[model samples]
Target: MLPSGTFVLGGAASGKSAWAESFCESSDLTLNYLATGQARDAEMDQRIKIHKDRRNDRWQTIEAPFDLAPALAALDGDSIVLIDCATMWLSNHMLAETDLAAAQDDLLLALQSCAAKWVMVSNEVGHGVVPDNALARQFRDAQGRLNIALAAHADLAVLVTAGLPLTLKGTLP
Candidate 1:
């Protein structure tokens, strides 16, 4: 059987996405990269391009910047789905001032019922010093809470640093 799900967290530049990509690509199954990044600037565009170059055409990329739950619903049962980076997705929703609570609720429901191997990537924003701006602080806390909730439901939780992955909870199968 599939090893349930994994919620992976790390800081910026951490190997979290790379590790998740590796996990998905190593498998012989059809791969799905659920990209959450939206090219808001040139830097971001370059980052997205770098990620794209790292993968071969064998992997299918789905650009779901928001309403990620619906994207999950549309996926067939046979793919290895890796949602690369949740922070960007959260930021995207926040930019639209979307209902965070409702989105998370729908996401949890989708995750629980999804009959596929899912790896969610998020930035662990709570580990560092608090941000100076109130909005930044709120974003940090909200992202942290989101990660915590996902980790609780995930069969595996991983913390990545220095290109290495440390299993925080559960086993890899």
Candidate 2:
């Protein structure tokens, strides 16, 4: 059976994905890598490639840059699914100018109902200096709210920084 959900929060290049991968690796189940990123530019393409290169061939990757709920729902059995970010997923919705509230609700519902073990990764975007632009500020606020909502429902919530993990809720398995 899948264990209760886990939420891992951190900043960019802060080893959150690596940590989440490790958490998934701890289990004997097959690893399902649910990539939320979209390589819309050169930098993002490189970043996505780097992440892909780090993962072993055993992982099955699903590129659900916009449809996370359906992606989660479609997966069968008890494989461990690592969603390598909530922020990117949110960004996709924001950029598409979709209904943020409805998207959030759908994402949460999928997480709650998925049969597989899930280790969700999200960026902690609100701890730094406030964004000077309205769009940036809006994104930061949305990210924070998304993290909180996920953490609230997660059985284990961890904050990672400088490649170290600090558990916020439940013991690390």
Per-model root-mean-square deviation over C-alphas: 1.3, 1.3
| Model 2 residue 20 distance off true place after TM-score fit, in angstroms | 0.5
For model 1, how does the per-residue alpha-carbon lDDT over 20-73 read when each residue is reduced to its tens digit? 888777777778889999998999999999989998888889898887777787
**Poorest stretch of ten by lDDT in candidate 1:** 1-10
Tens-place lDDT digits, model 2, residues 88-147: 999999999999989899889999999887889999988789889999999998888888
**What value does the lDDT take at residue 31 in candidate 2?**
91
Top-lDDT structure, candidate number? 2
lDDT of each: 0.85, 0.89
121: Cα error in model 2, Å: 0.5
